[model samples]
Target: MISKFCKEVRQEIFFTWIMWGVVILGIVGVSAASGFEHTVTGAYARGSVRWLLGMDLYSEGMHGFLYLPHAAIFYSPFAVMPAWLGEPLWRVLMIGSFAYGIYALAGELEKRYVANLFTVSSLVALPMVLDSARNGQMTLLLTGLMLLATRDLLRKEYGFMTVWLVLGFALKPLIVVMFMLIGGVYARTMLRLAIGLVVMFVLPMLMASPSYVLAQYVGFIGKSSVATDPYELLYSRFCDVFGMLRAWGMPVNGELQTLVRIFVALAVWGVCYCGRRMWGHHLGACLILTFSICYLMLFNPRTEINTYSMLSVVLGIYVGWAIILNKQTIIGGCLIAFAVMIAFSYEVVHQLTPGREYWLPPLLTCVFTGYVLFLMVFDIRPVVKVDRVSPTQSDMLGVDAEKEAEGLVMTSSVS
Candidate 1:
């Protein structure tokens, strides 16, 4: 078994390294051409500089630093470094973390087809990976943490899950959406995470004065309020539901928007709960994070087009599961085009009509979310357990009669 595992890994990894080498080059190329002042890394590192000088962490506009003061402490290492040095390093760090996330996740469930799954997903994830890496965006880091957190949850390793989830929460508080779902499943861990969050929230005070840190925290609260303000004057447009609606010439009322958010949040939690019950841990955990991230992009008030890069890790793996490794070739292929469309969403937006280009990815994501709910509610299992399957795949596989009948009965029962 060890020898066979080695062979399977060897066959796929032999060629995989070459592809990764290309990815590294792409990151280097983007870094070389990008000015330190222009990249998001510049903004990230600047917060630390501002904090060190005892300036306000949050400023007036979208261009102002928007994260918690703790985020500056997180970026301090990069801030101390020169821009040329920091830019490439930060980019590589995020993209590398994302790649490691893929490696870890693919290894967890399907040892035999690990490379096959890794290759397809990585290839699909590359565009967004490259996009985020170029800009030195932290979306990849958060995405990596999400994948690792999902893997830890599957292993019942709540200790490591707490570390990842807490660090992720400190970096971007919006991931509380994920925390809420995971909290629903693992209540005790959520308590540990809550305490962990308190520790992290105050960790910045050790480096700065308490008054200053407290003021920064207050500023963070004010900054967060603007995230849902559709009327706020900003250079960049939000790519959330508000963006989609406003693009269609239907501005939403604030009260209605809040109600909509609550309703959707409940529905998403229900979908995730049903997924866990219907699919069990192996597949359930992956879908939970996958759908949660999708929800984040569509509903989170300040979601930007490039922020959609957060979907790369999960969506890529899901597409590979659907089109390449999945036994259910029928509905699986449905995501293939979407994978491409989403990965290159930053580019696709330019090709679209000017008025509503930002709506494209979120709109497609809504459809994807509905498709997943359909699959789960119908108990339409993908039925491809990589553990027992041969390493070599045939041209195509069909739905076996027994599984098909089971799916029909489950669908009728739900109806």
Candidate 2:
């Protein structure tokens, strides 16, 4: 009887639409309230292009483009096109990449409908597109790349797939490193990663910058270290780390920060170790969430709710949960309700407080920590079942878990 209902739910597309409808409405309401269009647009338009190329990078005293070289490079192509051409073109590119990512993720799960649900729901169901589009941010593109690389990794296509991920690292080193932490350190992955970095990072630098320009690039990286953006949320969150340690009266210095980073890195490593042994995508999802949240917390001192771009990755994890977790216990249901409440409740909180100066750090910390724990524990499972590979998927050079599992476990792949 339960199985029958579960199948019915799985087949129900309207339910997914309804859920997404609510998400869309919420995004619209929030954007209107936040006044994102005018503010975000004005800021980016005023940013200097020369600085972005690592020449006068951060010369005007803003981390605008210095910290994000990968985004800078990709945006360079669109930068050449007229604004009218570039903005819309970039938006379309995001949409296309998102579609590719959905195909990749669904392929990971071996379910066509499941992947379609991810593409449609994730595209329209969140504020990602609106925010990325408004700010001309590459958040969605980065997300799509991360998703695609993860899907490839799961299928054991370590070479080509990891390139997408390595490119993401070159763009925003935080989240990609997180994914690597979760994927664990395998020889094949390491080799692929090295090759990808060479292609994506080293080659790009060599081609884009002359020897003299390369020296300037090194200077820019150095300047970025001392540069602090107070308005950035991640930087503020790093302050929180200091505040937390200081409250305990521990001197929050470079050494402490380094220590905390090491610990977080280890935590990421453990999560990936488990993920490597897992059947679900939760490991990938959790690593992305943990790393993104930590990155935002540590570096983005002025990140506002609008800049919660990485949250979309966590939302992807939730969608994965909806598919994999067949059992919905009251406890689990309550937790899910809490997650939804917190994710959607920020709007309400904003209305009530209207950005008053109060314990924002603790609130963010609690929310991020809870969500990561949820993904690692409830969403990811150790055992996964994979059947015969689809022809299209096989043609894509898919890995057969059954073949990989021949001398290992029961019948399916673990790790």
lDDT of 1 by residue, 50-108 (tens): 98889987877545687888778889888998776767778777877777777677666
lDDT assessment of candidate 1: 0.70
Instruction: Write one digit per residue (lDDT tens) for candidate 2, span 1-415.
Output: 4355446545544455455455445544554555545323222332225535445444444444544444555556666666555555555565456545654564465332222335433543254345444454555666677667766765667675777777777665645554465346454567667677666655546645556346645755765665542222232323344533433345345554556666776775666566545634434443543465555544343344434444444444444444443233453344344344434544555566554322343355556566556645775332333344444443433444455344232221211
TM-score, model 2 to reference: 0.66
Q: What C-alpha RMSD separates each model from the true structure?
A: 5.3, 7.1
Q: Candidate 2 overall Cα lDDT vs. reference?
A: 0.49
The lDDT for every candidate, in the order shown, is 0.70, 0.49
Clashing pairs in 1: none
